[model samples]
Target: MGWLSDSPQLLILKDCLARRLLSCHVYPELRNLPESAQGEELELADFSAFLAQEVWPTLPPSFREASFETRSALPDDLDSVPLDSTPVSFVDTLVSYGITADAEGAQTLLRKVLAEYVSDACAAPPVWSSTRARECEICEREIPLTYHHLIPRATHAKALKKKWHPASMLNAVAWLCRPCHTVVHQIATNEELARSYHSVDLLLEREDIQRWGKYASKQRFGVRRG
Candidate 1:
């Protein structure tokens, strides 16, 4: 009779431990180990630098992955400000579940990232100006500007956010001059663009982008936005 009371409590504890183990960074390597592995032999291999970096992809999602899901929930359309936390959280989720850092995590993670990106398309909405009149969002150069679709149009179906505004309006676009646009496409995939570089500020923060901005805008003095 006493065992029954203990059973539920034991089950709860085991469930908690299982979730915690699933969240471990080393769990995957252990999971891949053979049943015949010896005690000390296996324990030594656990700390080996050889398999550590090589096996990172197979590791279970870390706490950071769980944290990401929380931050990416509220996009601009929800009357929520796009916090600096949004993109950071998104990548964390994507890396945890995305096979190659080229895809989003679960559908929810994908949706949030897409929503935030789509909202940023308007570039501080309620403040749309002439494309020619405004400076390039990336280089800040007042040059010939063009719109860059963050999700690469081809992925629009995968990126559509049913929770946000309409699909027609959810273009997830950004402004960039020719050189900046070229540099972005050169370095990022559609996933990277849609998940991270949806905003001018986000683009400006990258070291690679900084170098490109310097090189691209070398002779082109920026035109101040009207």
Candidate 2:
């Protein structure tokens, strides 16, 4: 803990967890850093102050509070910190600090959260072809199809943190015609889309989307929905 205390690397880790940003394990720049550096920036002191003052303050009040609470929950006793002579692996050493059953519970929760974060960050983006689809997947109209992320990109960080969808489905998308695409967004909020209607099959299950798809399929390319 001494090596991490008041360090830029620790602050960055905390920031990632607080903001629900991709973890250092998956972030390319952080992962690429030399092991000796441990993801710390060159300007350690400046970076630490910046994170503590400028960056952390900009986060939501609730996030800041939560981060503070997690930090405060750690044991204050210097003797509780593991010794360098510990034979266990680094991670094992870190987790071994807690002597109580609650430590195991906390470890379980952390693993679940980290699993979701890493999976979402690792999911590949949809591979788009130079040639666009001739018809919308929804309405089957012969109009230019718009690429739509089933899980809205804007809500991705929050969605992953909320466990709305698994990492494998984060990059899922649908190609829809202009009208159908417009209606899809209009029909649900990003959270709702991530939680309930991410897949094309699920979108088709909605009466409004079904009705709109059928109506749009019959209309000519120039027709607009009122």
TM-score leader: 2
Output the worst ten-in-a-row residue range by lDDT, candidate 1. Answer: 59-68
> What would the TM-scores of all predictions be?
0.38, 0.41
- How do the residues 29-52 of candidate 2 rate in per-residue lDDT, one tens digit apiece? 333323435334442333323223
Which residues of candidate 2, in runs, are more than 4 Å off?
1-133, 223-226
Off by over 4 Å in 1: 1-133, 161-169, 221-226
Deviation (Å) of 99 in candidate 2 = 44
What local lDDT does model 2 show for residue 7? 30
lDDT of 1 by residue, 68-176 (tens): 2233433324334323233443344335433224333323333343343333332232323333337777767787778887556766665544212224323656778
Cα-lDDT of candidate 1: 0.47
